[model samples]
Target: MKFAALLRSAALVTAVALIPATTATMAQVDGRAGPEFAKLFAVFQRVKASYVEPVEDDVLIRGAIDGMLAALDPHSAYLDGGDLQRLETMIDGNYSGLGLSVVMEDGAVKVVSPFKGSPADKAGIKAGDFITHLDGTLIYGGSLDDAVAQMRGPSGTSIKLTIFRPGRDEPVEVDVTRGVIELEPVTHELGAGNIGVITVNEFSADVGADVFSAWQDIKKEAAGRVAGLVLDLRNNPGGSLDESVALADLFLTDGRIVSQRGRARGETMLYDAETVYRGDMAEGVPLVVLINAGSASASEIVAGALQDHRRALIMGERSFGKGSVQSLLPLGPDAALKLTTARYFTPSGKSVQEGGIKPDIAVPQISDPDFALRQKYQTRESDLRGHLINELGIKDEEMESDSIADPRFQLTSAQLEEQGVKDFQLHYAMETLRRTTKSTVALRPAKR
Candidate 1:
């Protein structure tokens, strides 16, 4: 249940405070004197005496700290008060309202993403949409915390969001009723052809144990035996690092699952299969994992580990490409700094920083009626400002597929709707597993 705070760009939640602090020191301690220090002090004195309005010392100091961290990376931040509470809510996995992860960008309130099965997502509010109005009142240039507060209310209440999508011609208004979104970190169901479909909503507490229990239930529900498994990680902004490693260990009986390399000696570590669970839970069963732009951090760890070992065939779109690790350094009792500590790499030494895990089979969500519109507005880690560059220097064009039309998947949205295939990615993966033999499920280069 211990989670290293990994945030979604759209829906930002955090937990980077639990790891052991590497270097404990004062936030503004007396250190080696630098000539720039004098300049900073002079500027502060001038602002205090000559400014038209008086500014409090606490406000100025906090602003200085935030500004310093903000320049480092998008993921590195100094969080306190409401921001700290937001991080806790991510770990708790329960909240009321639109279920949207949002941030302030250029004085505009932009949606990060709607949590899977949340009211915002159910109402079709895609990531990268700009919110200009709330209840028909203009809310531009407002604080992100204020915007998030306005969006929350008692369950059953309704809120209107005026969204302007990037590719759309005009702003669209959506009315969504607030609901208690108690995100069950994991959920599963038995599908046709004795396939067990496990959807990991988040990498929160006890993920490995929950997934193991889910596997047991899946086997019990099967008529004869479990035939295939589909690990659906779509829209799952990652959570606990330990849980992610432990979850990957469940399916990987041998070999290194992941490794972390950082400047500090404490941050450098390697994790293997038996480092967590005892053995592979599924053994010989065919496996397929589904990921998209929302699957990031710890989720990518699981996908990359399974894919490299040929334990599971990764499907769907590319992940969010967030391989950097965040360590929470305590500034004081109430506040802390979430610092980007290290970059993680797969067993094959592939760093998923700007380059996320590429699926073995590139599959798009062709069944959704809004598939085209959603694709036009997709968001990922590479899109976030101040993101660290990958050492390999992979280009953006190479990280994605063209999503071209294939004769094998010629079914249109309308045609698939008539055939009762609501999720084309899942449908096609299940069909592929039902038809193909185990030997054919081995790793194959993606057709990009």
Candidate 2:
């Protein structure tokens, strides 16, 4: 018999003899399944019967798959077979959907940020917007998976969203038509004094090659007269690790890029720079990396490595604290698991989990009048430690900041504001680059 037929027979036999209800469902859906499907069903049955509590079969099945995949490493994930096909499309940086990056925050699905040029951004879906309803149905308490499923649909379909913006007393309504969201990975502009401004959206599969190409293009366009390079990693929620390391290698001549430590693993695994690929760019070219709360994962690795080694000056808000590494494991033919396998540390041996990489100079994004007060306080190590202590009842001594410093890192908030540099962090970095000497710049006190 064919593989599909064998799977169907096995599923029918197991379901009829063991879990009638689950078996019935599997058999009905097993018409096109293969041997792998039968094996998965068998594992699901064993888990349902053996699990401590009377768990829902679906939950048990999903949990088992998740546990299975999480063991490999972080980043690999199992998408539902149908979603899997769509995922392949997404990796290509084009997908038809309502454009919004979302996450489960405080038990509610919140909008992280809307992509530039996306329908959501055009509709004014700013970061910190709380999504309360989808299609006029209350979805605040729903799972993120369910929320995403509801928000995504075929192209040209209209969906109404009720959002709570910070300043507004009442929730605002937005009607957005789903369209193809194409991510422009690298965008460049010629800034003042022939400086090059390059913005990296995300380190997708082709990001390494794309960045190398962009760098060449920038050099060619500027003809070796480029004064400075601003690499904007703001709001870039990371992608491929290989891309991150490869991109870092482009800038550094030598040094450890990043390291990973796992719970059961004996020791941390280190990734060091093997080769320097600067292309046609000159050595000692002044570079500045702009990061923000949205920079994470692979983005953090690059920024942290560069900052640790003093290869580039880092400026902007603190990055998103996502230092844990995840690995995806294939559970069955149709299901997969994405699990946190290890925690990543920068070359300086700092754990970025909960505590993110602090910028050499901090610069806050100006928020709308409504959000000003809420985001007034800078997210500092002490503040994060206090939060952890209060919420988790952990001792203050348990929290620690990673040790990484550059003698030239001197720009602070008060000093920047006092100097009348509204975006002082970036200004300081630019000025420091202009000077181009290995000397520290003293921060002037804020003017009263």
Candidate 3:
């Protein structure tokens, strides 16, 4: 079955609960009525009473809820009771079932990507795989929300997935047993010349404390005076917004970390820097932040704030565009709605909406031969030309000269190849820090 049909099925199921015959009187008496509500009720009632076959009220209500939320945006979604439980497990850094991020695309549920170290990842579930069935049931006619509800369960639970892979004539079936998934917040190591390399996976509730703990550990290992710091934020789909603000304040003594503006809000609320630097580190240290397409929301906030404040040099591909802020609204009876409440801005007042923050230097990843071949065929020089123009906001005349180049910006494909850093974004950051720190030491005054 087609993906669109599945989504329609899910939406239809949720809409049953909101059938006008069952809900209009209560909704109106509850004082939530306006012209929109009145029209919605009329249509819902007409559909429920006019349908030839008897339809369950529960199914209609659920479908309405799903349709309502899905209309808002891709990220804002209505999670059923079971799906909500799974989200709670993810936030707590533990969950069961196939660890894959799936979304309704082109009406069929498609795998966004499998989480690293997940059963789905290990089982070779690739991005863009269309889930045709779950267990013995035909999932092609259901909503993505309902599909997720069917997929999640307790640890050690086994689920079978039938996927339609690209370039394959026949579908593939994979049976995977769920396991407890634990997220690693901070991972640090001492690189060449005693440089501190720290990778922050996500900005969860405990991320602030975890970063501090990692910094202390790295400081001890470095014996003070670490040459430089390479903070890796690649593939980090952001979590807590509050945590991102707090994390940015750790390295900044004074400045507006971030700001938020809503539809009605004329004034922009600013989050200022902490009074003191919590970490025992001085300002003007050589810092390089690594970012890529996966760095989003809170991660983009940190990268943008730091780059705007001149605290760190951002090096990598453009980040994921997710500037909108979401607030969790409790819908009585143990249900909640995660709604997009506001749009965030960098300290410099740039709105990173569809347009993401541009890196100080653009280093295209060409480490893999297969990736290079794909790029050659799919993306020509003209493709990158528009990206440079749009991201830099430069006119065609400005590119006539070579003034756009910066001396500090260096590409590290060769060095990365030598170090076997297929994930070359992080290697580029480390090398940038090493070069910047050497320059800083040379420019420093001699000891008295």
Q: State the lDDT at 46 in candidate 1.
A: 91
Ten residues in sequence with the least summed lDDT for candidate 2: 10-19
Candidate that scores best on lDDT: 1
TM-score of each prediction: 0.90, 0.70, 0.73
Q: Write the per-residue lDDT of candidate 3 for residues 1-448, one digit (tens) a residue.
A: 2222222222110011111212222223446547777887787888799988877887787778867876775555555466555455444446566777676665678775577677888887865578998886788767666887677778888899999876567889999888766766578888877788888776655666677777778878986577778778866767666677777777776777788775533323577778324532535567777876666778888888788877777877776666666544445445555555567788887866545667877765555333433323331112221111133354444322233544443445565578677666566667767777544432232232
Better of 1 and 2 by lDDT: 1
Candidate-wise lDDT, in order: 0.80, 0.62, 0.63
Q: By TM-score, how accurate is candidate 3?
A: 0.73
Tens-place lDDT digits, model 2, residues 1-448: 2222222322110001011222222224456667878887897888778877787876776666655544443333455654444333334447778888776655677776687678898887877688999889999776778888788788899899999876567889999998888877677776556667777777665666777777778778885576777788877777666677777887776668888775543324677876445432435467788887778778888888878877777887777766766543333555433445466778887766656677876644432333344354323223432121122333435543334554444555455457666544455556656665434321111122
Question: Against the true structure, what is every candidate's RMSD?
Answer: 4.1, 11.5, 9.4
TM-score of model 2 vs. true structure = 0.70
Please give, for residues 1-448, the per-residue lDDT of candidate 1 as tens digits.
1123423221122213245434532234556656678877888899999999999998888878878888888888877777776776776657788888777877899876688788998999977689999999888977778888899989999999898888779889999999998867888999989989998887777888999999999999999878888999987778778788889999887888888887765667788889878888988788899998878888898999888888888999888889888876654566667888788899888999978888988888888666678787776778778989998999888886875677767778999989988899999889877876666654332222
Q: Give RMSD (Å) of candidate 1 vs. truth.
A: 4.1
Better of 2 and 3 by TM-score: 3
Residue 150 lDDT in candidate 2:
82
